[model samples]
Target: MRGLASASVADQLIDVVSRIAVRDLATLRRYFPALSPDEIADKLVVGTARATEAVGAGVGTAAALPTPPAMPAELAAGVLGAATVECKLIAELHVVYGLRAPGNVRQRAALYLAEWTEGRA
Candidate 1:
């Protein structure tokens, strides 16, 4: 029941992302059988770093606030954008391999997000 204002949001975000990384390693290998998982992971790591930077930049523009209650909408938007990029990467990989996911884009993203959250417990 923690609100967005909780400091744990950052920790939650990191935990979810780490879980996604571990899960996606196997997923990428499955979709791109010809490619090395390590290499793909390296590229993804680089992309994630860039996305993180973008989000940081977005958050930096907001006025200094004591809590997330004062956080700017742009910051939330930036985080959402980063999440979208991560999800889209997975979807696009399936498309590239001619593999049809079982559901629509939102459903597929939710499935991936669920995998990410599974590591929380």
Candidate 2:
């Protein structure tokens, strides 16, 4: 029963991560037409989901994550790198190009992924 409960929780978490990733990628693609859809989805969306999902969400928004517990180091690195890319895209879109919503989503995803990877929950 405990195992099943944990599995269910994990599943729910995955769902949330998926939703955020897909939405964020769609927004990102609008600004950067040069990037392939697959590339945006994999490196940005799924990466955010995996990294954030790993961290759990116990930590508040202001706190920095303390290294993910269950996640492999390589995966964590990939997520952070992706976050950097996302951040750059968002900065260009909002600061220079004046696209706001995408910028917001990307920023939020960055925070969520960092928190998730830190394993606060």
Candidate 3:
């Protein structure tokens, strides 16, 4: 249901992700159990930041940046995982919690994801 039609929310999401990617290993692992501390801490550091910044910069681009070129398989997977979580929770909050509009849903979801990820970090 969610799409990239909303630039503001998408921008917020990028900011959240950038911060999360920089988190300590123990902290990232605690929140994202699917990612090992080493997995997240090692190669993910660069990939995640790049992805985050790409999305952020693309907010004003005519077209969104395609997924980064040749991401480490692991970082690619982590980004997908995080994005899936963001999409699903955002849908739930919109449908169940009565938030309306794709932009609002994304912004709230970004906030929630940031809080959850950062808290553990």
Candidate 4:
């Protein structure tokens, strides 16, 4: 039962993360008025890599809080934090490229989650 409950919570968390819109098309375009979609995606890729590395690194990262936790706790935090960052990157890339995955928010989220897991934009 405990394991089941943990799984349920993790699923819910993933759903929420996937559904959340990190940015919209208009916002991305407005933010990068001078850059093409490909250029914007390039910048995002670099930023995401830096953020992911910060999350995985042990110290000096605000993204992974509760410093000095046990190994398991740190590991979990790093995983979740990096996932959140990657999701944001994927969402933003979709917006920049003017590509919306067809379906409801949940379905789109699932697609994005799959892309993230597969390690591609």
Candidate that would win on lDDT: 4
lDDT of 2 by residue, 1-121 (tens): 9999656644544334334433334466675567764555445545545645554342222134465563454444444444444444333333323333333553545444444546433
User: If ranked by TM-score, best first, what sequence of candidates would result?
Assistant: 4, 1, 3, 2
lDDT of 2 at 104: 54
A best-first ranking of the candidates according to their lDDT comes to: 4, 1, 3, 2
lDDT for each residue of candidate 4 in 70-89, tens digit (9 for 90 to 100): 65556566667777788889
Question: Which residue window of length 10 is worst by lDDT in model 3?
Answer: 92-101
Q: Model 3 over residues 14-99: C-alpha lDDT tens digits? A: 55543432233344456557854354444444554466566444442422335445344345344445564444333333333344
Pairs that clash in candidate 2: 55-116, 55-117, 58-121
Question: What C-alpha RMSD separates each model from the true structure?
Answer: 8.5, 12.5, 13.6, 4.0
Model 4, poorest ten-residue lDDT window? Answer: 58-67
Model 3 spans with C-alpha error above 4 angstroms: 1-73, 99-106, 116-121
How displaced is residue 5 in candidate 3, in Å? 24
Best by TM-score: 4
Task: List candidate 4 segments past 4 Å from native.
Answer: 1-13, 58-69
Q: Give the whole-model CA lDDT for all candidates, comma-separated.
A: 0.54, 0.45, 0.46, 0.75
Give the worst 10-residue stretch by lDDT in candidate 1.
Answer: 16-25
Error of 4 at 88 (Å): 1.0
